[model samples]
Target chain A: MSLSVRHILSVNDLTKKDCALILKTAQNMEEISERSVKKVPILRGKTILLCFFEPSTRTRTSFEIAAKRLSADAVNISSVGSSLSKGETLLDTAKNLEAMNPDILVVRHAQSGIPHLLAQAVDCPVINAGDGMHEHPTQALLDLMTILKVKKRIAGLHIAIIGDILHSRVALSNIILLKKMGAKVSLAGPASMIPLGIEQFGVPIFYDIRKVIPSADVIMMLRIQREREADSFFPSLREYSRFFGLNKETMKHAKKDVVILHPGPVNRGVEIAPEIADGEHSLILDQVTNGVAVRMALLYLLCGAKK
Target chain B: MAEQKLLMTEAQMDKAIHAMAEKVIEDGLSEAVLVGIKTRGVPLAHWLARRLAQITRKTPKVGELDINLYRDDLSEVAEQPIIHKTDIPFSVDNSGIILVDDVLYTGRTIRAALDALIDFGRPKFVRLAVLVDRGWRELPIQAEYVGLTIKTKIDEVVKVMLEECDGKNEVLLKEHFSKRT
Candidate 1:
C-alpha cells in the first residue's frame, strides 16, 4: 500500500486507517528495539536532520536514536549556538540545511506551525516533533502506542488528561487522537489552565481532578508548563498541587487498574506525587521506550519515499 | 481485466506443503527453523512447521520476516508501503533456517528477505522453500525445496490464498490483460 500522507504535521492530519497503520508499524519497530543487535539496515545511506528551534532533550534524543537505529545518518541542528543565534531567519536556516540534501527533517519549534512551514519549504519529508501549542504528533502517537500496549485497545476507555491544557500541544494532540480512535476523553485541571472552546471537542471538562479520576481508564498527568504561562495560571504551585496534583489521596479515587501516564520531564510533586509517578500504575518509562519505536516507524515510513 | 487461472486446488496445495515438509525432514534438518517472509509467507511457514512436526514428532521453530524496509523498489512502488511486523521470537544464531514462501519469481523478494534475516543474526546456513517456483529469475537466488514449478509471463500475478489468512487454500495465476482498443 502506498503511504498517501506525506508529512506528520498534526494528529488530525491522519485518518483512523493511518493511525492503525502507524501503530501496527510501531509494533514491528518495537521488536527491533528488543533485539540484541537493535539496528536495522532499512534506512542505510539515508540522512535524517533534527531541527529543534526550542530546547528539548527527550523528543530530540529519541528521534536521533530512532534514525540511528534504522541505520540512517542523523545530524542535529539546534537554535542555540547555531547560525540562528547569529541572526539567520528560520527559512534561511532550513533552506541551507535542505541544500545538504537530508532525507527527512524532524523539527520542534516554540512558535506553532513552524514544522508545517518547513515542510512546505523543503522537498524531503518533515515531521513535527512538537510545534508550540499547536500539536506534537509524534508525542501523541507514542502516547497512543503506550496506551494500546497497556490497555490492549483504545476504544471504550475513559482517558482523563490533567494539567496545562492551555499551553500543551500534547493535550491537544492526544485529545484529537484518542477521540478519533473511539476513546472517551475528559479534560481536568485548573479552570485558568484549561483553554476556552476546548469543550467543543465533545468530552466533558472538569475543574475537580478527584471527580474525573474515578472512572478514567487512563490518567495523563501533564507538566505544569510554568515557563509557557506568563502570569500564574493558578494561584501557586502548592495550590495547583493541592487541587490538581495526582497524589496518594487523589490516587485512591482512580480505578485500581488505572494506568498513569506522564509526558515527561515531569515536575514531581507539582503535577504528580512522587509515589504515583513512581507507582506500579505508572507507564511513564514505557511511554519513553515506545517513543523511540513510534518515531522509528514514522521515520521509516516517511524516509522510504524520500529515498 | 486480468483473467485468473486456478493452478492448485485446496487439497493439492496441502499435498505440496506436506511434500516440502517431508523433504526438509528427509534432509535431516532437525535444528532447522522456518522463517516466512511476510504476508503470504507467514501462513506458509506455520503450515510447513506443523507438517514437519507431524512427520518428525518435533516442531521446528517458526518466525516471520517483513522485508518492506529492505525492498529496493520501495521508493518506486508506493508513496507509503504498509509495514507488517517482523517477529522472530527465538535466536537465529547458529541455527539452520529454512526461509518459506508461497511463490518464488523475480527473486527480489527473497533477496530483500535475506537482507532482513541476516540483520537479526547470522544463521548457520539458510535455505529457501516455496510451494511453487515460477520462472524468470532476476537474481542468483534459487529455492532449495520446491513443491511445483510454473512458467509465466512477467506481467502475470501469482496469488497464494491460505485458510489462516485468506479463508481459502489455493494458488491462482492471473494473466494481465492490457486495455483493448
Candidate 2:
C-alpha cells in the first residue's frame, strides 16, 4: 500500500484511505514492541535524522525509539531557539542538514512550513513532527491509532475538541483527520481562544463546554500554548479551567464510556484534571505508545526503499 | 509479449502437498511445528497440519512469519515494503521448526527467514519444505521436501495461488516482466 503523498506535511494532505493504511500499519508495528527481540533489521543500514527546534520530551524520544526499534541509526539535532521567523536561516539550515545525507529527515520547528521547506531543500523524505499552529500529522495519526485500538472505528463517533484551538496544531490536525474519517467533530473553547473564520472548516463551534458534553464520545483536550502568545489569549488559567477543563464533574455530562485525550504537557488542573489524565478513560499513555508505531509506519512508507 | 503457463491445477497442487505430507510423515517430523513464510506459506502450513493430523492422529503446531524486515534487498524494492505480523506464539527453543514456503527460487528469502526465526529462540533443528523448487538459486540453500522441481529461465516467475489467499489452488509460470498481481 502507498500513501498519497511522499511527505506528510499536514492532515489535509492525506486521504481517508491514507489514514486507514497508516492506522493499519501502526497496528502491525505495535506487535514489535511486545517481542523480546524488539529490534528488527528492516531499516538496517538506513539513517534517520530527527531535527527538533523546540523542546519536546515524548514526540522526539518516540521517533528516536521507533527508528532504533527498526534498526535504523537515528541522530538527534535540536536547538533551544530556531524559530522560523529568521528569514533565510531556515532554508540555509535545511541545506546544511540535508548535506549530511540522512536517508530520512524528521523535523519539528516552532514555525510552520519548516518541514515543507526542508523537504524541498533535501533529497530525502521529511516528516513533520509538529509546527506552530499548523499541523502535527503524526500525532494525529497516532491519536487515530489509539482511538481505533479502543473504539475499533472512528466513523459516527462524536469527538469534541476543547481548548487552545487558536494555537493547537493537534486540534487542527485531529479535526481534519477525524472529519475525513467520518467522525463528527465539535470545537469548544473561550471565544478569544477559538480562532475566527474556523467555522469555515464546517464543524460546530461552541463557547459553552456543557453543550458539547452529552453527545461527545471522545473529548480531546489541547494544551494552552503560552509560548506562542505575544499577548495572553485568555484572562486567567483559573477561569479557563473553571469552564472548559475536563474533570470528574464534567465526566457526568459526557457519554458513560467517553474517552479523554490530551496532546500533553497537560496543564494538570488547567486543561484536564489529574485524575482524568491518569484515569481509565484517558488514552494519553496509549497515544504516546502508538506515537512510536505510527512513526515507524511513516518511516517505512517513506524511506524503506533500497534503490 | 510475456507468456503464462499453468504449471499445476488445483487437484495437482493438492496431490503434491499430499506427497510432501507423506514425506514428512515418513521422516517422522510430523510432530514438528509448521512455520510458514508469509503470504502463501501460511495456508500450506495449515494444509500440512491437517494431513499430518489425519495420518498421525494428532495435529501439529503452526505459526506464521512475515520476513519483509529480514529481506536483504530492503533498499532495492521499488515500493515501500509494508511490515506484516510475524506471530510465532509458541517457544521455538528445543522444538523442531520446519520452515514452509510455496516456491524456492533464489534461496535469499530462506536465508532471511533463518535470521528472523533464530531471533525468536534456538530451535533444536530446522528443516525446509516447499511446493516448487524452480532452479537458479542465488544462495547456498535447498529445500528438504519439495513437491515439484522445474528448470526455468531467470526471467520466469512461479506463483502459487491458494484458496484462502487467492480463491484458488494453482501454480502459474509467467515471464517476470508481465509480473503477477
Highest DockQ against the true fold, candidate: 2
The candidates' interface RMSDs, in order, read: 2.1, 1.7
The DockQ-based CAPRI class assigned to model 1 is: medium
Instruction: Give the runs in model 2 whose Cα sits over 4 Å from its true position.
Output: A81-88, A229-231, A304-307, B1-4, B175-177
lDDT of each: 0.88, 0.87
Best by lDDT: 1
Per-residue lDDT for B133-179 in model 2, tens only?
A: 99898999999989899998888889888999999889999877563
RMSD of each: 2.8, 2.6
Q: How high is each candidate's TM-score?
A: 0.93, 0.93
* lDDT string, candidate 1, B49-163, tens digits: 9898898898888998888777787555545566777888788888899999888988999999888888888989999999989899999999999978988888887788889
